[model samples]
Target chain A: MDLVKVQLTNSEFLSTGIEKLDNLLEGGILKGFTTLILGSPGSSIEILSKQLAVKGKVLYVTTDETEQEVMDAITRFGWKPEHIEFTDIATKYSKSVLSREKKRVSIYEQRSKLKLKELIEIGSSGVMPAVKAQEDFLAIFSNSAKTTSPEKIILNSLDFFLSMYSQEEVLRTLHAAKVANIERAGVLFIIMTKGIHGEVFERKMEGMADCVLELNVIQKGSTFERFLAVKKMRNYAKKIGIARYAIDSDGFVLEMIERIM
Target chain B: MTNSESYVYNQNRIGLNENENAKSSCPCITGIDELDQKLGGGLPSGNTVLLVGSSGSGKTTLSMQFLTNGAKIGERGVFFTITEPLFKLTKNLEKFDFYDKKMIESGMVNLIDLRIISERLGLDAEKYTVEDASALLEILKDIADELDVKRLIIDSITALCYRLQTKEMIRDFIFKLGSSLASMNCTTILTSEVPPNEVKYSQYGIEEFIADGIIFLGDVDRKGDLIRTLQVIKMRGTNHSRTKSAMSISSKNGIELTPLLKSRV
Candidate 1:
C-alpha cells in the first residue's frame, strides 16, 4: 500500500525546544517523518530526546530505562510526566520474561484461574510468546494512536529492541511504525546508539529512517565535547556542520566549541 | 599432578579452606588464584587497585578477566572505557572464554565509553581542571548506583592522564576516583600504560600513591624468548607476596599467572 505523506507547514514542524537545534533543523523536525537519533555511549542523546518530548504530544516507548527513571528524567528537565505517556517495554520484559515466578507459571494455567469472561476479554495469558509479544508491543502504539493521537512518538534506543528480537522482526515492526507515522501525519523518533551494532544492521535501519541525526562525544583534553550532525534528512537542506552542546542542571546548552565541518 | 591442575589446587587452598580459616581479609577474587594469592587473599574489598603496563601489555585482558569472573557469581560489573570504545572492547573481549555476551545482555556487565566525553571537552594538554574530573566522577557514580556494580574497571587511567596531562589533574582524578570507589564499597581496577622499561609502577608516579594497591605487568626476556610477568608491588591492609610471577594471556583461560616467587626480602 502507498503510504500517505503529510504536507507540513513551517508552523507544523515539531520543535526540539533547543532553539539552536530547531534553527538548524529548518524551524523544527518535519511532521510525519521517521527520524533516527544515533549516538554512542555518553553522547547525551537521552537528554536531547527528552527535551524534544516537551515539544509535542509524545508517546515515549522506553526499552532501556525504567518508568521511574524516565519520570525522573522528565521531571529533571522541568517537564511534567502528564505531557508524555510511556510504553515501558524494558520493565515489562524483565518482569515477564526474566522473573522466575512468571516463567514457572504457564499462561494457559493462569487463564484457568481466571473466569471465562475475563479470559475472553483479556486473553488467557500470563506471559506472551516472543512473536506474540512483538505483535502486541507494536499494537499498543497503534491502538493508542486511535484514541490519544499523539503528535510525536519516541522509541528510546532501538539497540535493546534489536538485542531482544531478530533483525527481520524488528525491521518489520519498524516498517509498521513508519506506515503508522505517515497515516497519522505524526512523527516517529527512533533512538539508536551507534557502534552497538554491525555496519550492515545500522545501514539497513538507516535506510528505513526519513532523517538520521548522529550525536558524538569526543575527548579533547580533560573535557568532553559533544557534537550533533544531521547525517540524513529527506527534502530538507542539510546543515553544514555539527552543533556543539553540553548537559547541565538547566538542560542541553549549546557550547561555544568550534563546529567540526 | 599436571601444572594447570597443580595451579588450580594451589589457588583453591585459600578458597577450599575459607570455612576453616576465617580469613580477616575476605577479599573478592580476580578469579585467577595465583594472582589473588600474590595480593594476599584477592584484592581487599572496596579498594582501588591500579594495573599499570605498556600498550598491548595485556592490561585490558587482565581487567576484563577480573570483571568477567565477578560476573560469573552474579556479582555485577561496570567497565568505564576511556581509551577504547565499548564496541571495540566488547568485540575484543569476545575472543576470550571468560567473555560472556549474556552478562552484558542481562546488564550484569555494563560498558560505558567516556572517551568521547573527554574528547568533546577538549581535555588534551596537562591542565588542572577539577570541573572535568567532577563531571566524570558524577557520571561514574550514576552508573555505579544504577547498576549496583561491585566490580569496576577503568581500562587505562592512562588515557585520563593523557587528557588531563598535568600531574596535578591526574593526581586529583585518581584521588577522587579512589575515594569514591571506597565509599561505594566497590572493588575497582584502574589500568594505565607506562613505558616498557619504566621502573615506576604508574605513568605519573602519583597513581601508586593514590591507589590501594598496584599490579605491574611487563615483559621479561627468558632465554631469548620474551615472556610477560606480573608482580604485586604493594597492597595496603594485608600481608601479600611481593614477588614477580610469570603472566600469560590465553584465549581459553584469559589471564594466567604463575604462583608467586619466593619473597626475596
Candidate 2:
C-alpha cells in the first residue's frame, strides 16, 4: 500500500457515484463534524444518507413513525445484519430513561422550563449501552488511527423529534451530538429531515457541523429527477446554492457530477 | 400552573457512516440489453427509473424485463405489480419466454402480487389513500430482504401519488422512499400510465419527474398504421440514445423493439 494519503480538495470532493449530483463542497466534506441534509419531504435525503454509510455507524431516530417501511429501507441499502442497527428510544429506551431519571433526581428549578442539562440527564440516564450493541459499534470503529478521538458518526434520518419531543429535548439532542463529535472521533452526521424541522435542524446542525448538503428532487420537464447541493463547508473553498445530482445505481457508485443551483 | 421541563441525552452513540466514494448516481433498472448499452450499463442501483406509456403499451412488460434480468443475473428481484394480479403477471411473463420456473420456486424472483396483496392488506380498491403507501412499502421491504432483493420493480408510483391527498404528504413520503431505496442500493423501476393527450406532461410527475432516468413508450401513427416508439427523455449521469425507436407488442414475446426508419428486407 502506498504510504501517500491523498487528501481531497474542494474541486475533487464530488466523486460521481450518483446520477445527477456533483461535488459541490470544497473537499470531501469537513471530516469529523456534524452535517445536516436538509430537504423537503420526498427528497432523496435518506438515499443520500444511506449512500454515505461507508465509514461510520448510523443511528436513526424516528419520532413520527414506527414503520416497517422505513426499517426495510436501511436493509435495502445492502446493510447486512451486522451493519444494520436499530434502537427504539421513544418507547423502550428514550422515554423510560428520561422519565426514570427525572422521577428520582428530578430537580425542578421552576418546573415551567428546564435547561438542556436537565434534558440530557433524563434522556441518557439509566440508558445502558446494550452490551452487544456496544461490542458491535466498537468493532465498527476499531479499524482506525488509534487516537483519543473517533472517526465519524451519523444520526441517520430524524424528523420526528420536532413534533414528538420538547424544544428542550431537541436542544438536548443537539448538545448530545456535540458530545458525540468528540466521543465518536471522526464523525460526520447525515441528519435526514423534512419541512420546517429540516430548517430548524439544519440551523442547529450547522453550528455543530463542518459541512452541510441538500438533496432535492424536482420535476424538470416531464421527468422526476434529483438535485444535490453543498450549502456549507467549513475551512474549505466551496460553491453555494443547489447542485443538480444525477442518481445512478452502481451500488455505492453514486456520481455527484456538477453544481446546478 | 403550566409547568415545562428541560430534556437531555448524553448518549455516546455511533451511527451510519458516509460512503467512501459516495458520489455515484443511482439509475433505474434497464432490463433491455440494447437500452442498457445505449444508456451506459443500465440505471444506477440506488436511483429511480420511470417508465411512462399509454395503456397496453408494454409498460408492465418493460418492468418485467427489469425484474427478470435482475433475477437471471443472480440479484434478488422483486416485482410489485399494482395494476395486475399475480397470476396475470406470471401469465404475461410466459408470453415473453422470460419466466424461470426454478427462480420462482427458489424465491429468487419474487412477484409481490400487488393485486392480491391489496386484497390481503385491504388495498383492493383503486381509490386508496396515501396512508396506504407506507403500509404497502413495509410489505415490499419484507420481501426485499428475505429474498435479498437488490433490483426492485414497482409497477407504478403514480397511482399512489394520485390517490394521496396533499402534495406535501406525497413529497415527504417519496423523499423518504427514494432516499431509503437509494441507500438500499436498489435499482428500482417504476411504471406510470400516460393519457394520450397528456403525453408531454405526465399525470403524476413522481415517476417521470423524480426518477433518475425517463423512458417514454407511445404509439405513433404512420398514415393509418399505428407504430409504437420508445424514446429516452433523460438519463442524468450517463449518455442516452436520443432517437425514437419503433417497438411492438407481441403475443409470444410481449415487447419487441424495432428501429424507427425503414430497414430494407
Candidate 3:
C-alpha cells in the first residue's frame, strides 16, 4: 500500500534567528525536512536547537551528553521557559534495540491481577486470549514512538548507540527513526553528528532535507570565532560557506556582505 | 553595645506576622532534644533560619539534619547552596543516610542550583553589610515565595556581613533578614560566626531583636578537650531555658545538645 504524500510546493522554513542566512535558504528550512548540524564539542548547535525548541513541544534525542548538561547549555540562551517542558527518554530503554525489559515486572503484576476464569472465558469465546489486554499494555509502555505533530524535534547525537551496536545497525534504525520523525510527523528534525564521514552524512541529510546548516568554531589569535554555512535550500540560493560572525551573552551574530548582482 | 549598659529595643516592628499560621503542620523532629525545645517544637513552620559558620563548622550538617528530620516525618525540604559546587555537595552528604533518598525523586526534598547566579557575578567583591542586606533578604523572600518553603537555614550571615564593615549596617541586615523571614511566616535560623574569643552575641544587635529567638553555638576547651556547646540565649514569646549546653558532633548524629549546662558562670 502506498503512503499518501501531501507535498506543499512552496515549502517554508525558519533559519531560526539568522536573517540573511534564512534568505539564502528560501524563507526558512521547510518543516518536516530533516537537516543535519555538524559542529565541535563547544558548538552551539544544542543552543540553536533549544532556542527553536522552547516555543513548541520538542522531543530531544541525545546520546553524547547527559540530559541536565544539555538543559544547562540551553538555559544560558535567555529563552522564556514557561511553555517548555522536559523529559528524559534516554533511560529505561535498551539502546541496542527497541526492547524494554522493565515492563516485565509490571506485566507480571497485571497478569497476577487476572484470574483463571477470565482467561478461560475469552479462550472459550474463540476470542484471542489476552490480545486486547496485551495491546493495552503495549500502548501504555510505548511512549517514545508517539509522534506529536506540530512540534520541533532535536536529535543531539547519533553517537549514543555507538557503545551498544555496530555502526551499520545504529545508522539503519536511527535513519529510519529520523525519516519517520520527519515524513510521518510534522516537525523540524534537527539531527546532529560529528566525525569522519560528516560530509557524506551531510550530503545524505541534504537529500532528505530542505536546508542544511554547518557550524564551525575556529581559533584566531587571542580569541575564539564561529562560522555558519547554509549548504543547500531546495527553492533558494541559500548562503554558502563560512561567514564572519560575533557572539555575546545572548548568542551567535552573523554578517554577510555578499554579491548583490 | 555593652551587655549590661546596652539593651535592644524594637522599633517600627515593620516585619512579623500575627503568626496565625504559627506552628502549622511542622511535623519535623530535629533529632536534638534541646534545640527542638528551644525552637518551640522544631522551628515554627514557614520560618527561615540563616546558619553562619566557616568551612567545616557543621553548617551543611545542621541544614541536612533539619531536612533529614523533615524527610523522616514526610515533610518536604529544599536546600539551595551557592558556596560550593554541586558534585562536592552530593559527595559530602552521601554519608548521611537519614537524608531520605526518595525525597529528591518525589520533590519532597529538592536542591536548587544558585551557582548560576553566583558564578555570573563580576569580581572585586562588594561589602555585605546591613545596608545591602536587603538585596540578599529579597533573594530569600523570592525563594520562599517560589518554593513555598516551610523551614529554611542560611548557613552564614557572616558571609553576608563580610562585605559590610559597620556594626549598625550588620544589625540592619540582620533585622530586615529576620523580619522578612517572619513575614513569610517561616521558622528561620541565620547562622553567623563570632570569633571564639569574642563575646557570645550575634554580630548585629538586630539578630536578637528582630528574631523570635537566638541560639549561640561555640567550642569550649574543657581540660584540653575541645567540647562543642550550644546555648539558647533568648526565645521571645516563649519560656525557653537559658542554658549553655554541652554539644557533640558525630557522623551519624549531626549535633547532639546535652542539657547539662545548669552550672552557670
Q: Pick by lDDT: which candidate is best?
A: 1
> When only chain A is evaluated, what TM-score does every model earn?
0.77, 0.56, 0.61
* Model 1 interface root-mean-square deviation: 21.6
Ranking by TM-score: 1, 2, 3
B21-109: candidate 1 lDDT, tens digit per residue: 24443577888978776765578878899998888989999988889888898889877776665667877999999898888778787
DockQ of each: 0.01, 0.01, 0.01
Measured over the true interface residues after superposition, the C-alpha RMSD of each candidate is 21.6, 20.5, 26.5
Between prediction 1 and prediction 2, which has the larger TM-score?
1
State the lDDT of candidate 1 residue by residue for A164-206, as single tens digits: 6688888888898889888888888899989878889899888
Q: Which 10 residues in a row give candidate 1 chain B its minimum summed lDDT? A: B119-128
Residue A12 miss distance in model 1 (angstroms): 60
Give the lDDT of residue B265 in candidate 1. 34
Look at candidate 3 and tell me the lDDT of residue B159. Answer: 55
lDDT of residue A135 for candidate 3: 24
CAPRI-style class, candidate 1? incorrect
TM-score of each: 0.46, 0.43, 0.41
Error at A123, model 2, angstroms: 41
